[model samples]
Target: MKSHLIKDVGAKLMNRGHRAILAISGGRLLSAPFGMPTVELHTVGRKSGLPRSCYLTSPVHDGERIVLVASKGGDDRHPDWYRNLQATPDAEIVIEGVTRRVTARTATPAEKAELWPRIVASYRGYADYQKRTERDVPVVICENR
Candidate 1:
């Protein structure tokens, strides 16, 4: 949980590796052996104004809507995708093999308090990730755009 080179490097390696696989497999093998569903978040870069995407697990979704945790594996800083979404809420999400346009927003404090437990219940790692950081990790909700 503490700041350590191994954890930092491992996280980067895992993300990069997972991203590569997703690109190669065309979303068929997202997140590999993890049974939980993973989705591709497409956000316009805040700085470059270019399309960027990263994979994330959806701990909660209701057919038309999905919730993505900006936990950054509980790191102190927000993930780039989350930051980009803040600058440009217009985005896209690829669930399974279907891609759809979406508008994203960080959940309100009241909503975070309401959804936290349900998310943690779906994936225990999210709770552990929070313990590793000082900041309240953001929760992003992406609905049909």
Candidate 2:
């Protein structure tokens, strides 16, 4: 399937009925299906100046912060949500039915060096994704705003 199509459908499914399904299924529905927390990220479109959101899996969530990968399935281009966050760092993230305000920023080289191993350990696919593209995949850290 096309990436954008998958993204749009995923956002729609999560927004429309996935939450209810997750609740009814006792947290085993889609929660951490990928060994990571699923997060609904809310941001403002940089150009449109309108609300934009997408469901993403966070590879690391250590209570104080959540980590997102801008891998875009190794498509060689940054995801729209990633770009949005670049333009406007302020955002909201919904995890386990709780919403929190956050500020998003790309990890520094030092931070990435420290976090990359843990991130890859959480999901090996991310490492493969990184190898598939020339551009470096950005690791985004979101902390309470």
Best by lDDT: 2
lDDT of 2: 0.88
lDDT to native, each model? 0.85, 0.88
Quote each prediction's TM-score. 0.84, 0.83
Q: Pick by TM-score: which candidate is best?
A: 1
lDDT of 2 by residue, 1-145 (tens): 5976877676567556766766698867787757788898999999999999877889888778999999887877788899999999999999877899999999999999999999999999999999999999999999997
Model 1: CA > 4 A from native: 1-12, 23-34
Q: What does the lDDT read for residue 83 in candidate 2?
A: 95
lDDT of 1 by residue, 29-81 (tens): 66533456778788899999999877778988877788999998877888888
- Clashing residue pairs found in predicted model 1: none
Positional deviation of residue 58's Cα in model 2 after best superposition, in angstroms:
1.1
